[model samples]
Target chain A: MTHLLEAKFKITYPEFSLDVDLNLPAKGVTVVFGPSGSGKSTLLRCLSGLERAPSGFLKLDDQVWQDEGIFIPIHQRKIGSVFQESRLFPHLNIQGNLLYGYQRTPLVERNLHLDEVVQVLGLGSLLKRYPEKLSGGERQRVAIGRALLTSPNLLLMDEPLASLDMQRKAEIIPFIKKIKDEFETPIIYVTHSMNEVLQLVETMVILNSGKVVNWGPVEEVFSDVQLRDAVGDGQLGAVLETTVSEHDDKFGLTRLDFMGQVLSVPKQNIPMGKKLRVHIHSKDVSLATAAPVGATSVLNILKAKVGKIGAIDPNGYSVDIELDAGRPILATITRKSLSNLNLQIGQPIFAHIKAIKMVHEMDT
Target chain B: MDIPSIDSGPIWLSLQLAGVTVGLLLVFATPVAWWLAHTRSRFRVVVEAVVALPLVLPPTVLGFYLLILLGPNGWVGGPVQALTGSVLSFSFTGLVFASMLYSLPFVVQPLHSAFESVGKIPMETAQSLGASRLDAFFTVISPLARRGYLTAIVLGFAHTLGEFGVVLMVGGNIPGKTKVISIEIYDRVEVMEYAQAHILSAGLLLFSFFVLVMVYTVNRRLPVQVT
Candidate 1:
């Protein structure tokens, strides 16, 4: 079955107008990524019915939420939105806040029990605490749980982790990943951080200047050189979907299998046989024309074919190389390295994997 | 000099008037205040100015208009009198009606500010959580605007308690019926009853100070405290 979440909106402000037409996957985490003032939040608001665009149409799966003359009110649309700020009800303790949505959702439509949501988000201990009393991470976890308890058909998170400190963000990312894995609901996550995009997105939409520059599976969209540059600021990177093949306890290393190649990294707590999405930044990778023998400091090495070569930096010192090593990965080498090696498309090469950082580990 | 015992009739009447007036203002002005706080409609300015008219218009001037409006042949009074066959002017209901207009802004402004401070963020969150606009207002907005309710209620009740010119113009100084505390004090002073007037005036002064002190203290204590 091909389930689709479709939306078309035309909203005109005094200074800016947002016009978007999208047919997004109805399941999995779809990311809307863009720079500031690109109308990412505005588009999310249009979907949520908070900002009504005069000309709009939205249909999720078999249901039509909005058409020419008919528009479903926000509450009737069965959507749960989490904003940058937790926006939790200050007066209500966590338990009360969580149940706020629970009580509103029709019993027939309610999918997850309150206890299940609490345990999933690890919010049991904080249930008696108020929003003001909880830490930023704790508040966001509760906010996510509160939204989940609503039994929404669609979940919209607009920079849910933006307000948190780095440590707090690390604390909440796994829970967000957990929701994607455990729940059947489709999630539309809006963010500007390339890290978050790589970590969470399955279907990625690149929004620029109120338009979608690209949209598709994260792997393909990110690997395409033209679309990768659309992310801006030269933060282009590649996302690889891999599985944990083994964890060497004694050696303190984890081995991940991607396509047919295995790469080893510092040991992760993730159990063996778990699937993961790892992002390798273009700048982080180094290449060699021929395979290097035995331990230099780099733990992993793989054979690759050069796909595309281009200068993606302002200073023109570094060149971005797209490689095919079972999966497309980006590597940025100095202009000097590119010239010295005489790199060209279709040329055979070796990607000296100096580092392999897990974007996020997911168990399947 | 020995102080004469104050008659409780006017004091009791004033308390009743203030209580009823505050109650009516909360029920009527709450929705109006919420609208004024959130609406982008062009009529918002005109509505706001009209609600605030009582604050700037002299009490006597407001009372004069109410007197005409609530009179048997006047706008409100005519319809109301025809329906119920009772004079709206010079009645307890008349005093309440007069006080409601006089203290309109006192209740509306505080609630307006409180609602504005709450902004649309929480309400939007609530709506997204499957709460209707009405449900969100009561569940999310009302709780957050508790401090506003306190300020509005205290100010409304207090303002009504000390009302004089409007009460006189509309209700007149009908002893034991429409004679509020302020009117009773005036009557005492007019009759050269200095000791009785002194007792009532001083009591009101102390009571008002206490009420204001309580309001300020509570306002300082709770960030969102409503009760």
Candidate 2:
């Protein structure tokens, strides 16, 4: 079932004001992608009814959380929020911490079993430990489990991975993905990291300075040059789901079937049938009018057709490419590259997607 | 130890004064400290300053003002007398009232800071988890702010136990009725009975010191740190 969460709210602070109207998809991971202080987290807070909007409306799964005179307190809203800082109660043991939210939901409203959450978060051994005894990653996992055990209608995550190391972040992505795909409840995931947005979500809401700059499907929004400007260098966009085919050792390459073509990347040891997450920052990419026969680069090039070119800023530009041999890749190049390649709208080109430059983060 | 007066036994009178003052201050100050720690009201600093006034004011100054208030023909004194058919001035009950005011901030400021340091996050998170405000206060804030309570109770008790000027002004050192330890020692000294004064003074010193040391040492063990 397609779900919808609509909100239009305004909050005023000492020197800043956040006024935004957001419409997020009901299922899968809908990412709120934006720059810092763009009211991304504030939007999440408004959705959960944590910060009441003086004059606004919010609806989640046909339930009105807040609209004019109608206001539902946070506990009554059934929206679970995971703050960036793991705000676990220090006095409670790990089991007590988890049960803190579990016991809150009415007996009639509880859905998932207690043992299942402990298993999912690998918390069976940590039940007796205090909050301070656990590491940062452990605390976050408990936080996730605590929210899940609450059986909320929706989960709101405000950059939960921002405080974690890369390895710990990778450890949690599969769990987040499982919640996104296996569960019916929709998730509003907020992040300033494009890699995170690309790795977990299918829908996107691009925000800038407390306003909705763009919102649409993940692929379409990432390709938008204006939105590309919203997400800066090295974090630019190209996302393709590729399945492992075989490792070509003679050429030191691993071949994958992506979209409609057989593409190759550096000798990745991923087993057969496993999928890989490919994120190519627009800046690290180069476009060519002809597929060069002899290139020193060993892997990760696709034959794509140029769709449209647009000016993202005064000095930079973005190009949309459809990789006929594989999945589509969105490449943002400079105005100079476009002119030098003599590329125009509707021109066919070879995208030199670099092997080492592309980022690969695994998910179950 | 045997002193005859219109009042009853010395030990009974001292107990009444200590009990009344400790109970009254603890009751009034808990809520006041909670509010001082929580409210973002613009007048909080002013209220803080006023609450702290008794701490620095000369004991006699505080006592003089309270004496006038509780004295017959004075505003509070007349109302209290008319309602209860008894005057508070120069009585054991009056000494407790005077001592409570003198020790108000000692019990309050530490508790307030303790509550403030406990923060709103844990309480708020607990409330969102469906714990009521009262439940959160007891289960979360109280456990985290345990040291504040220890500090407040000990300081309040010790401060009142050692009160001198205020007791002299309001309590009037009536033997067997209004003479708390500090005043007992003071009275002995005034009559040039140095040996008696030294004994009582040493006893008080040992008692308050032991109480404070035990409180602080035990409180140090439960220091709160969030993960």
Candidate 3:
């Protein structure tokens, strides 16, 4: 049987309010993406039972956590939550912190073992030290490990990397990915960083001004022109899931295959057949009416058909055009270029891809 | 100069009163301090001012009110007299009750600040990790606030040990019942026993200084020190 998570919440404060209704598959990582003050944290808190919405309904699979006149306390919700700060108990050593939740979870319900978690988070050496003794990255890893040890049915992370510097964030992303891959617990991660959304999100929920603007598969949502403001102008792009098909060691380039088309990027150390997420910014793509006959410096040129065209910027100068190569891709072009090329819906075209970034390497 | 022998009676009584007062105050003041630290109710400021009244009010003023309230025909004393067939005023129980009121702010304020410094995040994190509210308080908050507990215990004990005015008004200098060290010293001075008075006064001065030193030393250490 397929597992599903359903949630509906309406919470009001004096200045801000949060209203959302979401039914998402209880699998992988569902990222709640928004800018600051967009109620991302509030929504996560409601789901975790930390904040009680006066009117809300929530259920994970067959278990109902909250409904009309029925509210479960936070401790009874069986959720593991990690906040922006690594809220490790200062009094407890790393080993003790990790075991805190594990010990509280009933013996019959425990599934994730302490040793395996310690190994995955690379926490073996630091187990004897207290939270104050560890570096920021180490402390966050312990916090994540502490949450995971509870064997929760769902995990909620509210900007777990927000407090760390870029170097520390880079240090911890892999462990987060490992947890996503190894654990069966569905995760609801809240983040304001588009980079985090690209690197970790499988499903994306876009929150704007205390409301959910859009929610769907990450690739489709990223391609939506309506998300231009929420995701920032520079971040409007397409996410393509591709597999490593060939390695050209001589040219220091790697080839990825997606939908019978090949995209080459700077060489990656990942072995062949590994799946990767390639992020293509809309600004990097240019359109041509006919296939270029002569040699071009751009390595990737794919034949696609224009699917939709609409103005994304408020001034109507720049337009975001959706192109259907096999999977949908988005390109941002100026009005001068659109009229110069006379681009229209259903027009067959050639897309010149100037750059591509390999965002995440999926574990097969 | 020859050293005068100190009477052990008042010293033992003072120790016992301070011990019992500290013990009882810890239990009663903890919940009040926790509530003050975390509550958003408008009554918080009102309650805080009320708890702090003893700190600012004269001891005799508080004692006079306690004297009236705990006397034979007064509200508390009347109810107690009917139920237990004993008077509350001028008794050991009355002195203990007065000391608890007198030293309440010392115990509650340190604990309030400590609980405030510990903040809401750790408690929420603990609850999210499957610990109940009570369990989290014992496991996470208590350990984090140990310094505050230490300070509260020492201050409450020392403050109760030095009580004189409130005990005098309520307990009326009853020997072996409510005549604690401070009153004994006063009695010695009254009878021109300067040498004996000097001994008890000097002992109290040294003990208070030591307690203050311990509290300040702990507070000066790095807050996250292990244990």
Candidate 4:
């Protein structure tokens, strides 16, 4: 159950060098997050043997893919990679592209079936189409199916959604969540979007200037203010991992059970008992001194205590608050509101969540 | 009403030369063009210049060099003559060899550009999918470069069909054995046999015009892909 992927490698360009020793978990989605030109994709390329690090050692569980003396070729590694551009062969039909890897992989080693992959990625209708004819999201879904059909030991995705518009990104996120839940294959995903990192990742690796700035569970790394500051724009928010406890079709609301509190939001189509990751923007959370009146429009009310208070910026009057609500939740409020509420570390307060949106969900 | 009869032997021989030259060049130049398109080695410039020499060098200059190379006492010819008791000069095989050299650039340049346009992304994607290097090339890269192949084949065949100086210098006029259509037309006109020359020349004119038209039409239909 504890599959480990170890990478001790160093690669140098004329102006940049990436030297890192990482022991990444080889089961769930491990997101490699960083700014542009920070060696995030390059690290995945090294793992996939696309760019060989001269002095490197990589081992996935017991399979040693590369070392000082032994180096496996890219085709032999059985690692699937989905690049930003899809990279689907323009000449091949969708079926042909999907089968390109399936046919090459030995039958004895195949763990996924063609029909299962086709159904999972919803590629049944588009099987006869060419890559040029498909939309960006459709192309990516096909690419994912193609990679999954290879039965890869590990899948590498480098900014797979970076090219799509918001709607297209929404279209592809569910498939990714399904893959993480339904498949046993490990995924090393590269992304810079904090929203994506929160929505998808279980293990988070923060890379800055070709070095690992932080690496741990997603919740632990996200709650680190220093790391949050490193990833700027202050888009920091709380990602609550919850299970759908009930769905009230009459009131059009879904009740999510998290840390013994049931939070209500708009009704979701997901089946009851399914796990979901919900993102609550810090700005949307307002602190309350006592439980709000019964008729307030604010839907979510949870008891939490202030944990850490961040410094106020020079121009802006806002400050970030870390709450100890079983699972840590982040809230940003103006200094004026903070003083009026007289918030302090370890002080009990009520968090009135104005809105809660389900960012991603997984089948149990 | 007296028109001299035009011999078709030279016409058939010219067709044979063009066909053989195009076929051999397709096999020979593909690897060279692929290397020229993909390699970043220092020797690429030198090799490129050598392949392109036929484009600028006078046809007679190249033919003279080939004539020496295939002559009875020359380096390549002497060894062949010793082994087989025959010389390559004035032979159909010699003409094929001369045409290959004369049209090297015609076959290689287009193929090289085509290979370059195919780029490395698709091939890299194929490799990621577990295709071997050779398998990926045949399946992904070749189809994408189909237009390049068409251009190369047409240009190589047409250039070989129209060759005069190289064929004259290397193969000479040996009647049915080595006299191609161009040399035959020249010989007819030299003896003031304008009627014979006119008949032969007209057929060649029609044939060349038709080939060019077909090339333009086909290229327009499938428009040459740069990427």
Q: Which candidate number has the best DockQ?
A: 3
iRMSD (Å), candidate 1: 3.8
Candidates in order have lDDT scores of 0.86, 0.77, 0.89, 0.86
Would you estimate the TM-scores of all the predictions? Answer: 0.89, 0.88, 0.96, 0.86
* Residue A43 displacement in candidate 4 (angstroms): 2.2
For model 2, how big is the CA root-mean-square deviation? 3.7
Residue pairs with backbone overlap in model 3: none
Q: Which of 1 and 4 is the better model by DockQ?
A: 1
Candidate 4, what DockQ? Answer: 0.49
What's the DockQ of model 3?
0.60
Per-residue alpha-carbon lDDT of model 1 for A1-364, expressed as tens digits?
2358999999999888899999987677899988888899999999999888899999998899888997999988888899898888888889999999889999999998889998999988998877888888888898899999999889999999998888998888888888988888789999988778767777888888788888999888777565544676457777888888998989998888988888887788887788888877676788888877665777777789999876556777877788998778888788888889998788889887766655476445
Badly placed stretches (over 4 Å) of model 4 are A1-3, A243-274, A282-323, A331-359, B73-75, B78-85, B223-227
Candidate 1 achieves a global lDDT of: 0.86
- Against the true two-chain complex, what DockQ does each candidate achieve? 0.51, 0.52, 0.60, 0.49
Give a tens-digit lDDT track for model 4, residues A188-279. 99999876886778888888778888888876676544544445545566777888899898999899999999898888888888988887
Sequence-dependent TM-score of model 2: 0.88
Summarize candidate 3's per-residue lDDT along A303-353 as a digit string, tens digits: 899998866588778888999988889889999889899987899999999
Identify the runs in model 3 with alpha carbons over 4 angstroms from their true place: A293-295, B1-3, B225-227
Better of 1 and 4 by TM-score: 1
RMSD per model, one decimal? 3.3, 3.7, 1.9, 3.7
